[model samples]
Target: MFCFQCEQTAHVNGQAGCASTKGVCGKDETTADLQDLLIYQLKGIGQLSERLRALGKPDQAADSFTLYALFTTLTNVNFNRAVFTGLIAEAARIRDRLRDALAAAGGDVSGLSAAVSFQPATDLPGLLAQANIASVRAGLDLVGEDVIGLRALILYGLKGVAAYAHHAEVLGEARDEIYAGVAHALAFLATDPDDINALLAEALALGRLNFTVMEVLDAANTGRFGAPVPTQVLTTPVAGKAILVSGHDLRDLHNILEATKDKGINVYTHGEMLPAHGYPKLHAYPHLVGNYGTAWQNQQQEFAAFPGPIVMTSNCLIEPQPAYRNRIFTAGPVGWPGIRHIQNDDYAQVIQAAQAMPGFAEAAPAKTIQVGFARETVLGAAETVINAVKSGDIRHFFLIGGCDGAAPGRNYYTDFADHAPKDTMLLTLGCGKYRFNMHDHGEVAGLPRLLDVGQCNDTYSAIQIATALANAFGCGVNDLPLTLVVSWFEQKAAAVLLTLLALGVRNVRLGPSLPAFLTPTLLNVLVEKFGVQPITTAEADIQAALTRQAA
Candidate 1:
């Protein structure tokens, strides 16, 4: 049960990984083993799927399932061992189905590895025994740590890619390129190659695929919900029967809003869902109230204190606190052992729970923050931004966002955003914005200095904004007065980081700590090739970005 896919992974004796009975994120040993087994089987499914595709018999269902199964393995998304067990069996079924399809197409499967040809046991005990051989540790003894880390990077990056692609698929957007890419990567992992250069190139390939996944997601989001606009969202609670929808799933939130409409229930967003207020179609519901809490790490306290039911729409769900355990419901791939699960866009259970419980008794003091400065909104004011830069009213831009965690070093982002010069604009997204989005950076040239560019899911939007500004100024992104300060907690951030690197966008300041999955050797390679930097002090990095000439 060795895992280091997230920022908060445990450390012992200068090692960075979680290998105990339980992980830092509350992932128990059984669950961790099951996740590994799931990945192993997914690789098998991917092997079969890739071959089936090569034979001109691609199965969209199998391809989509591979993405979704990978997504469920992401940190903080699912911890129910039973769910993983079921997924493992389902993976076996899918693998066999694909195998049969390949055979029907007259493709040879004689020389496949155990990952492609192994059988799954029907019971948990038997499955755990099967999983023991497939744990991440299997490669450490063979390929060594450096090669193992390289493989983990590609595998985790693929998981992140699948997450974005899955989100886009939910929104009725998907491409064969993304599906095929996932299968190919999965199949690549199945072979367990030890070639360092090949693994590095594959990781970059995953990044390129993620870029397309993010674009499809961008189009899906804007196509369905329209581009976000600058709207002032009340951070204060509105007194009413309430349901707080967390995670980054807009489709789930929209459905909950539709079902709870006129039901005397107000819907508030938590975590990454805070940006939902910026979308026109979503915010049109008057009952869709303000954001209820901060980032995902605070959910225990926040979820318990919130006066009504809670719905987790996607990843970043922690184990439910006893106080709010029964009232919290899981939707999409998010899960906990006892939490009631919502299926097929159903909101009846969540709505009933909200109505059955006492909501906010009194309105909180009125406080508001503006959001929805996604690429379109920011670019709509392109001339103003350009003039501000030319007139020296705007000296620089900071993209200070990513996954937020409860780790100690996280306050750096808050301080960095707060201390940015008034002449500069800060573009923020993801839950990391919770650290300083509330801080008043004031406005520059009729635009807020602190721009909320939607959620981490909108990394594409952030990239687009930077690229547009670069085009306007006639320079590459790295040659612009823009810097990326990121805090990553899970695989989604990993995928985004890879996208930035693959785009040759260099000098990204990543913390609260370097990824455990990145051996120093691999990190040095990135440093040499991409100039990726571990974050220093907020003051120091800020000064460097402001004064350093862009390369």
Candidate 2:
């Protein structure tokens, strides 16, 4: 159907839709349509919040509910039919109430109401049935060349907010404003606007709000997990039956570790889960063995040959092949129709799956990957880090965070890491670190040139580290000798970027390409306000970023 929710939309401006039988990402047509509907319904729920708030009933605002709902609709969170259906039904009820409220207010809100309308045309076929397929293609069509960029930017920002809000809810942390604000903004974006300037302004506000939501999520994570500490994680799979856990869900990782503790089954982190090694609470699980696989896009080949069962806790789930289908379990929001998905948020099914599958009985890894640069560990070494900076031993801090993909261009990350100067330090989080995490770049002073700061969600750790450095330097975050070079492939990355923007962190570099959703106006706003730029050649980008610091 007409889906442009990700950076990998078909190249054609108007006509390139996901294949009807299969998606570019291996998602079948049904899943793609459902994702579209999920977003549409979330918009409805968001519209309802606007109504409740306008009625001086701000207390009635259901932020947690809206945020969770939107989060569920994010790229790779939930995929269970039952769960998806229930949420859709709930959203429908909320949408109906919103329609009634706006109608009764005697206010002409048709424009805002369009997104949530419970009409057949909202279904998948109806959407794809448009005679001109070009109309549904991403970029240069939906919002027009002029405004498409802006709309995409705001939409992506909202998606980021929804992700952070989602994580916050997982930890029992609720912020009504984030939920309501995101929903209201989504509803507004869906509105048929006659004033382009007004839309652009709101879009900018969405970026700002996304930042605030990310900070809240950061606090929630650190508060619950304890500030991440510096620890070493192994990449070599250990002996005995092993289970590989991927995606960005720490809670899921915790549950799996708890379920398999001393059960003769060892657990390993993959993709964004690699950062789990930093949390004392999580690392305490002795059997939580090292990581496996390189990055998200390499899953098919990696997972196929792995000698253990694999569990996905979040995004970047490649649809499994028959060769490894039985050995895999999808948990949390990641779902593929034929795949065995965890029925509940619980880990019982995952445990059972691991038990039934053939797993590793090999020896411990030859070497382990280092981790644990979270706030506390880094701050604890604050004096050492500060001194190093002062001595010019650690000349630059490169914050390389974001998702990993199989695109040829993704090789830029590896090259950049390989080329980082001897005195420069690379602080990496998220699966993107796969490019160079496995490589030993030697050390800067006593510290490893590359520090694995945990998973994508652990962007919190990066922020904490940056803030501490800024405070020590008596300057804003940007003024600190740090740079952010991020690679995004999903909504979670979107949230992290928004958080950076919200905090007014400038001069960040994003690559391999900008999202297809952003309209030109929105892109300009981000470039103008945040100084965000696309990544160039690894050499050029690194030199430019480093040169800026020397300036």
Candidate 3:
């Protein structure tokens, strides 16, 4: 039950992973073992799906299952052992069905590997027995830590890709290429390549794959919700019955809004859902109130104090505390052991909970925060931005974004954003912005100095904006007066980092700490090849980024 895929892995006496009875995220050994077994079966499904694709007989259901299954394995997404055990069995069933179909189609399956031929145990003890062999570091003695670390990097990156793709798929947006890419990557892991160089290259390949997933998601979101527009969201609580939707799933929020509309209940966005207020279609809902809290890490405290029911739509859910466990709901791939989960997107139970509970009795004073500066909204005023740069009115562009966590040294990001020059524009995305989004950075040349560019998956929007700025300035993205200071917390952030490196984007700073899975040798390789640097102090990093322009 060794897991080090997130920023908060157990680090004791020079140890770097969560191999004890319970993970730092509250995932116990049994749940972790079940998750490993499920992932192992998913790899088998991936192998079969890849083979089926080669025969020109790809199964859409298998593809969707693979994506959702990988997403559930992400940090803080799902901790329900029963849910994982069922999925493991389903994966084996899909693999066997696909194998039979291939044989019926005259494709030879006799030479296929054991991953395609082996059967999974039906009981918990038997499954745990098989998990030791299926674990991520199964052959660590032979392949060594470097190879194992690189493999974990690739696998974690793919998990992030699957999460973003899953969000898009539920919104009626998916690509066969993405499905194929996911299957190929998962199957690649099944073979356990020991070559460090090859494994590193595959990590970059997963990065490029994540870029495609992010693009599909960007289109799906904007196409369905309309491009994000600049809007001021009220932060103060309103006097009414309410339901708070958290995590990154816009579809869930949209459906909940529809269900609770005109029902005397107000819906507010929390965590990464804060950006939903920027979407024109979602913003049109009158009862869709405002953002309730900061990032996912603070949910234990925030959810406890909130006066209504809460719904976690996707990843980054911590263990639900007893105070709010019964009232909080899980949707999509998100789950906890005993918490109520919303299947089929039905919100009747959640609505009832909100109706049954005491909501805000009196309206708090209105306080506003600006959001929705996605690519479209920013590019609509690109000429103004470009003109400011040309006239020396804008000194620099700083992309201070990524996932946030409870770890130390994260305060560097808050200080970095707050300390940036008044003439500089700070472009932010992901839940990390919660650290300083409320801090007033003022404006520059008629534009808000701080730009909130949607969620973490909306790194696509950040890329688009950067590319446009580069094109207008007649320079490469790196040559622009922009610096990427990314604060990573989980696999999704890892995938985004790989995307930046794969695209040859250089001099990006990543912190609060680098992934524990990355060995010192692998870290050196990243530093030398990609110009990736571990973040120092906010004052030093800000000065270094600004000084680069002078050179």
TM-score per candidate: 0.98, 0.88, 0.99
Residue-wise C-alpha lDDT for candidate 2, range 1-551, written one tens digit per residue? 55556666666556444555555665555555555565666666676667667765443344655666666656555555455556656666767776677667664565555556754244445543422322223434444655654555566667667766677778777666776688678667555443668766776577667666666776777677776777777788766777888877777788788778778888888777777777778888899768787788888888888877888877777768887888788875567666777765667766776777668666753887788777677778788889999999999988888888766588899898888888899988888888888787898778678877777766766787898889998988988888898998877787677667767889988889777666566678779977989899999988998898889
- Model 3, residue 499: distance off in Å is 0.9
Q: What is the number of residue pairs that collide in model 2?
A: 25
Q: Please give the RMSD of candidate 3 to the true structure.
A: 1.0
Q: lDDT per residue, candidate 3, 182-266, as tens digits?
A: 9998888878788877888888888898999999999999999998988999999999999999999999999999999889999
Distance from true position, residue 123, model 3, in Å? Answer: 1.0
Predicted structure with the largest lDDT when compared to the true one: 3
TM-score of 1: 0.98
Encode model 1's per-residue lDDT on 246-269: one tens digit a residue: 998888888998898889999999
Descending-TM-score candidate ranking: 3, 1, 2
lDDT for residue 473 in candidate 3, whole number 0-100 = 91
**Shift in Å, residue 371, candidate 2:** 0.9
Location of the lowest summed lDDT over 10 successive residues in candidate 1: 542-551
Worst 10 residues of 3 by lDDT: 108-117
